[model samples]
Target: MEITNDLNSTFSPYSTTNVNATAAPNCTDWPHVPMTTLIPAIYSVICVLGIVANALAVCVLAHSSASRRTVANTFMLNLCVSDLLFLLSLPLWAVYYSQGYNWPFGNIACKVCGALHNLNLYASIFFITSMSADRYLAIVHPLQSQSARDPKRARLTCILVWVLAFACSVPTFYLRSTQHVEALGVEACAIHYTSDTWFYTLTWLKIILAFLLPLLVISCCYGAIGRHLLAGTGLLRIHPSTNAPSFKSQESCCSKPEKPLTPQQCVNKGSSSSGGRGGGRQLEGRGLERVLWTVAAVVVSFFCCWFPFHCVTFIDLLHGGDPMASCWAQWTIKNLTPLTLCLGFSNSAINPVLYCFIGNHFRGRLGGLCKGLCACLKARGEDHSHQRGSFSTRLSSFSRKLSDLKDLAIAEPSGSA
Candidate 1:
């Protein structure tokens, strides 16, 4: 519940501007409001944007035609669902922060939201790993992997991922407790560890299960996939040759000989390799390269987003309140902690950007998917405008006829008189 629990500054904040000086343990020599407002703002924006974006991703991914379902798409759909569920839990925390770190919600809400916080972390990380693994199998073992790459297997894998993620989270649901802090005079929801033994146990569990294990899996997959992609000779030998990077650099990855091959020899080698593979293999290789590129980028982004937070958490636990630890280190964990949390939380929103906005094919499909939605609204607006225009035209026509009748009646009366 460290993730979902509210932290109150039991230490007094350094007064800034018109803010009141409250003697709280967590408040430092800095204004709490800036940190307060900033964190809530982050949560609020991520909640709203993450919901919309992940919803779009989930809807598009789920509606994939039966003919189009693949291992990657299944993992992506699972990732979208995980992030959407995580985003749903943020509003309550945002409200908690906005109300000055008070837990207005009861124990049940706290545990539910707290469980979701950790669940999002594990589930999103696992799903991304699942996606990378899917690409790995497709690229490295394309022939052998096909039998296992069906939608049924993908669904089963996703089910296991969800089960594993939530299985770890189940403990938090029972472990989290809310208590009134007399100093702050507010209820706070936090994990009440039975002992330092349990605290150490959970920390290790987090490192192994959430961070280290996932990183190892993704790294191995990408490494194998990268070796496979870069294994072949010239770039022109691959399908979609234009998009491929110049393999003149890749030739360096190979051992340099005292004498290089002549133009004819090089061309023959390229031609031989190209001709050896069928067109289907070339197409598959090209698809393999595309997935490798996207998933590699995703893997890097995932590391960059979550690493800082985990590093901080590791330090906080490893030191275990050592006297040798400097005030600066403590301050770092204090000040940067919330920011790092925000950064990690930002990952929930970023997958849709990576999967839908940045990847070319997915982006195009998402655009096509949303286009009809936008068009529906546009047509409705046009219909309403046309109706208003016709009503105005009729109203003016009626007014003009009435004026003409009045004029005729007056003229006729005068002429008769």
Candidate 2:
């Protein structure tokens, strides 16, 4: 929403001959559009939808055993949190837009809301890039990944991401304020950069940090992952039985007549037998395939959603032209902007869905939970209603088991550490 204004202002310099005092500093003319009908409805719908979807995603990720402590899931959770915070400001925007850009809320609210909006932009990009980096490490440098895969390290990384995201957003607080226009009844809250130099500099910085850099990182990571997966799969086909002997020998050694082997010796023997030359490659390859596919889906979704919005904005900036000159084009672009932004926002909500659908273990556990819940409900409805206590007990037990499974899912693998 904030970016919409930015895009308009950026392109306004070349569009209008008359300046409307009611509009923000950079905007040339306030198009006399009645916000009462349009802006409120649009903002309200987006706010409600984004908040509900993101909240549900958070709940699912929190409750599902498959999403708990994983590095990828951790990033997703943080992304959802940021999205929720961003959504908090949307109602305020809706009210302002409904009032024809008048700010009933004070200067501080304006600044805070503006800052939060930008904060989400940077925070989302950072977490997405971090997720990509984690996958890259897991696939491309499996041995080295152990050092960075711990929960503590992952938590620290999230903190660092927040810090950087906040730093990037600081400019919004400084630049955003309510400006009163001479002849208009409305007041606009907008960024008032000291000069064109500062404005364009910040704009380009955002484009680079929040868009271009993340795009590049995701693309490269997924590309490497894809290549590695293909190579690994090819190798796996060539050595499908390479680890079979090791597994057989290990099982035999475990059940054979007693031998005086130390626990460490036994572990070493087991590792030696199971650590077939190609097994690591095959596992790494499969992991890479999963990571690449997920990242590819996310990256493609992001580009599809944001590209049109950014392209139109940048085009106007370059051409020094008026989008409004072409009424149909302006209307089309305006309609498309919200849709694109919505799609982009929906990315936060989709990660948990991807995890649930793509992960075999997660699907099985979720299925079990559903079955348990259904059974518990059915038992409670029986004529022997005194068995309600037993139904409760069963439900509690099932919940506990689900919680334990979730803990296991989030926990770092022993080998990873």
**Which one is best on lDDT?**
1
Tens digit per residue, CA lDDT, model 1, 93-173: 777767665778898998888788888889999988887777666556644565676679888999999999899888777
RMSD of candidate 1 to the truth, in angstroms, is 10.8
Best by TM-score: 1
The reply for model 2, stretches above 4 Å from the true place, is 1-42, 63-68, 182-184, 232-293, 316-343, 355-417
Q: lDDT at 213 for candidate 1? A: 86
- Screening candidate 2 with a backbone cut-off below 3 angstroms (N, C-alpha, C), the clashing residue pairs are 65-406, 69-410
Model 2 scores a C-alpha lDDT of: 0.58
Give lDDT tens digits, candidate 2, residues 28-82. 3434344356656766776777787677656655675532456666776788889
TM-score of each candidate structure, all chains considered together: 0.72, 0.64
| Error at 271, model 2, angstroms | 19
